[model samples]
Target: MARQSGRHFSGPRLSPEQAARQGRISQLAIARLGAREAIAFLNGNDEKLGGRPLDLAIESIEGLRAAEQRLDEWAEA
Candidate 1:
């Protein structure tokens, strides 16, 4: 018998608006921090986020709003 792959297939789902916002945030990240740094920033755990994953933060409505606010602040700084 063939062994089944253990990897989960489903990924985090987002609404259209949420996705658009995510894209905007990503663009801001790229512009402010450079592409590589922005990617790392999104993938890395954040101190200000109480040690939560940034990926998780950008997945939900509230989380995305918070992330945008934080990113906006970062841009201004």
Candidate 2:
């Protein structure tokens, strides 16, 4: 679906823990940004994330934390 939608994802294969974190971030985005916007945000590059999105978080735990932090800050605002 993402490829069909022209979204590009480049990162490492996700571990179970990383996948769980991704799911949590998605849920947070859904709650704060709404479903459609959350999907777009997840698929889009974020400046706060160093021009990376949640998809790139799979490459490293630090990347996942950065993504989570961005979402957390967004939720607080």
Best by TM-score: 2
**Candidate 2 lDDT tens digits, 11-70:** 657679878768877887899889987888788888767765577566567777788778
Question: After superposing candidate 2, which stretches have Cα over 4 Å from the reference?
Answer: 1-13, 73-77
Instruction: Give the Cα error of residue 39 in candidate 2, in Å.
Output: 0.8
Write one digit per residue (lDDT tens) for candidate 1, span 55-77. 54556767766776776666677
**What lDDT would each prediction earn against the true structure?**
0.70, 0.75
Highest lDDT: give the candidate number: 2
Return the lDDT, model 2, position 73: 75
Error of 1 at 45 (Å): 0.4
User: Model 2, 45: alpha-carbon shift in Å?
Assistant: 1.1
